[model samples]
Target: MAGMPTPHVSPGLYEVFLAVARAGSFTAAARVLGYTQSAVSRQIQALEDETGAALFERLPRGVRLSEAGRVLLPHAEAVRDRLARARAELAALRTLDGGLLRLGAFSSAGAALVPRAQAVFRARHPGVVVTRVEGPSVKHLGLVAAGEEDLAVVSPAADRPAPEGVTLHHLLDEPMLVALDRGHPYAGRRDVRLAELADEEWIVGNERLEDTLFRAAPAAGPRPRTGLMAQDWIAKLGAVAAGLGVTLVPALAASSVRPDVALVTIHPDDVPYRGIFAATPPAPTVAATAFLGLLRETAQELTPATGR
Candidate 1:
């Protein structure tokens, strides 16, 4: 003998079935659902065809569930309950009143921008949990593409622009500052031209950041004489304080520099600047949207170009 076929139930059919089961009559279900009685009967017929069993017993006054419907009742109720819970969860996430926001950022943003935004967002929406991961810009961008991070704070290298499957929204253009020892010859100057520092030994935070110096260097200018390779901001500042070498600093970080080191603006027609971007997938999550707004707000609020 052939076996019975599996039923293919849609969410719509479940609603109709549940209405008819509760109302105990096609006319009453139709009235409750704003459908005609004939429409309700047709829907029941289609459901019966799909399930390969009669779910309602026709009576003179009303209808009652057949044995098949009684068996399906629990499963139908379970699906309805699960869907309701899912909708509620999604609503909470959309409201930003409660949910998890996974974010990634490069070192500089983690130090200043990310923290500032997180503090504001937490105060505004205490139920939302914001998590952060710090790494290179490329790594953060990749995480955003892979859906591991809802959004990322990245300063993408010019040559290696944003990759496919990710959108990088420009937030700000951050100027580079030269960190010098307080006693350096040009430390007292308000702003020193990059040309004046061509002869000084440099302390680079990261080898990759070497390009920042060159971009502001004069065409015929000699390359910076680099000595120490430090990755952390404090260490780079410490090196400059000890007179090991001067290092480049971004405006976002100038406020954090130690008093031992002075941050000087580079004067030139073309000042080297890094672009900060909020990276997201084509469709961003609700929490991502809220956090991105906070990131941009923090950037604009703290931007030296914007006045502080």
Candidate 2:
């Protein structure tokens, strides 16, 4: 009887095999893994040559694993998962210095939370680098899930659930306020009712789902009509100042309102408060932890009365 040839597969070939198996097609795997389809095919071919057995059967649509391929699939998956975990753990080990901290944040938190935290963190540990991107809450959360960001500052919203393999640190429950042109009818009022503004044309933030916490008395009946939608808070505030429409903003954000605009409390019974949280991957680095601490401190300073 003829004996099987000795296997001589390389680690790179195994990685390619695992990617193809997970993705179910060379093209799909290449797209997900940032490699060319030809490269993936070559690696699989090399793997098959080394093992002296066919690993895949070419089909009209794609390819299917052969007997040899099926036999190695579990082992390949294990190797890939182990290598990924090792790389992440090694990166965490170099957390103190010379590592990147990729952070994402919603617009309001980007303006206040991230800046102050970065300032303090850089002062304390100058070796670590900080990178930040600002977007809506849902987008920030998605980045965290996709491993594009190490940490994020996001508001908890019903539609945007926390991603897997991530942890959340509740920072503070910030009250929402109505921003109106200084000459608007409710600008001087101590508090405004939801019913009073139902018919008013509203300028809503682009992330309306996140800002909906400010829509007081939503459970009661009709809510304010959204006439304009802006992604940036500054633009929304500008719209409010231009008398385009009323907009709701976080109290912390409202603290820095323009001279032409005023922020007034909306009754709590009508509009409920929303919380801000510092979110990160399950295993964040020392630098990330240090930065989060500074964020907490900055939030406290910003709202001394609440003490964060």
Candidate 3:
């Protein structure tokens, strides 16, 4: 006896079988599939040859399903339904209709950049769920590199390079601002030089001068005395409000500071602007790309054409 037909069938063969079964005739299935009647018959023949079972019985008027065809109907329908659902899910991801976008950012960016971008993203793609994590820029960068975060808003350190497996898109260079008491003489000035504030006590977030925001300032002049250390923004601003000392604030965060504190732009030559970026993996998700575009728009709105 001849060897049995190898059990091999393509999705297209099942599709033709389904069409012919529904239409009850090769000619009708051809019309539904936009293929010639001979082509439909050839597909059905191939499917039967592969399955080693006759799937249809010819009739004087049309055709009827064989016992094997009836047995296979539901399985073919299931495969067809599964493929359709898979296509829909892929489409949703492309269109941002559904998916999750994981985000990370440093403290200051949470003040405006990240929040504004997140608001716009949520408004546009309500189906996409966005979750955010806040911490230091280095931590966010590491999370992004490790694939825990889809994207991150970070002010990259000048001396340190981004971790491997990460790509950085520069958003802006934001100038540092001095957060002083309302009663401070420099409060009303358009800008102030660091040399003028050398005698003043500085409120810093880190105990080490190199780790604080002031590290960005040129090292030529005498370092301001950092007498107070307050890791929390509330404590730092509270100290500044009471005229205890002044702390450096990123320009991105200037809008969210307390009204009792004054924000004075530091001279460009004194403390250089910090470089802000959106960090992502080599292949970012569609939602991450959309959120990054929104971040760029918000960054532009916050900075003047002349540059901050």
Candidate 4:
């Protein structure tokens, strides 16, 4: 009689039992496992000793699991499946062919870079799963630092760079573009200056986001009035298209601009650019590294170094 007990039970012992149970004979189990019949018998005996239960009943013709064996059968099968899964996951993690990539991104990057990276990643590694969270870059930085996320596409404030234990891979500098209704007086121009739009109302996703822009443009004098505050890129762009006000659109988000709105570059000195980075643990997993490379490629496509 075997029972769960004092010393550790080797997974091998249960494996042997499962083989014997499946084959219904020690000799058959030995043949399948490439072990001698005596070896199979000894391993099963050891399992029975450890568990204090008879895992099989012997008849003149063959063998079958006893009452105790039936109880342990499912446990053995589960352990076998678990080990198989563990091996597969480890292999995936090593090769970047499978596993999950937990990614965090700020609003603009989520609107473009992260999705582009995810699509390319899935094409190359279909078995890998990607989960994403959207928030301010500062929040994403904390998630990466805490190991809650594998990595993030962040636009950390210049003075507040990567946190302790995390590293930043520079992606690109996204110059801010002004989103204005096509009907605005300066809409026909390819570029505009911050000083020109100084008195114009500003549209923003939220007050908090507006603060960042306002802080940077204090040199322009009074903070631009907030005529309308929309909660998402689409809403903000829509409002601008309706002649509500203007909002800043990152270069990363330029492609998603509304058809009726113009994304006009600002004068170089007044143009505020946010640095994009791939923040990760110093030694990221294969999946994270692979995805990071794809993100860089996507960033290049969005903001080419050629400066075109």
For each candidate, the alpha-carbon lDDT, in order, equals 0.82, 0.77, 0.86, 0.82
Q: Count the backbone clashes (under 3 Å) in each candidate.
A: 0, 3, 0, 7
TM-score for each of the candidates: 0.78, 0.63, 0.81, 0.81
Q: Which has the greatest lDDT? A: 3
lDDT for each residue of candidate 4 in 28-52, tens digit (9 for 90 to 100): 9999999999999999998888778
Q: What would the per-residue lDDT of candidate 3 be over residues 1-308, giving only the tens digit for each residue?
A: 75875756699998999999999999999999999999998999988888778999999877899999999999999999999999998899999999899999988889988998899999999999899998888888889888999999988788886789999999988887888899999989989888888888888775232354456555754476767888888999999999998877778878888899998897888776788899999899999999999999998888883223
Deviation (Å) of 281 in candidate 1: 4.5
Tens-place lDDT digits, model 2, residues 1-308:
65765555578888889888877899998998799999998989888887778888888888899999999889888887898988876775476645678888887776666787888787767767789998877777777777788889888674456778678887777776777888888888888887787777788765764347644354653465666789777898889889888877776665466878878777778766678888887887676787788878887777643211
Candidates 2 and 3: which is better by lDDT? 3
- Scored against the true structure, residue 207 in model 3 reaches a CA lDDT of 27
| Candidate 2 Cα errors over 4 Å, as ranges | 1-95, 159-161, 209-211, 214-216, 219-222, 228-231, 304-308
| Model 1 TM-score, all chains together | 0.78
Tens digits of lDDT, candidate 1, 1-308? 54756555678888889999999999999999999999899999988988888998999988999999999888889999999999987888888878898999887777688899999889988888888898888888888888899899988988675697789888898877788899988887767776677788887755466675575454845476666778777788898999888888777776667878877776644465678899999899888888889888888877864212
Candidate 2: worst-modelled 10 consecutive residues by lDDT:
209-218
The 10-residue segment of model 3 with minimum total lDDT is: 207-216
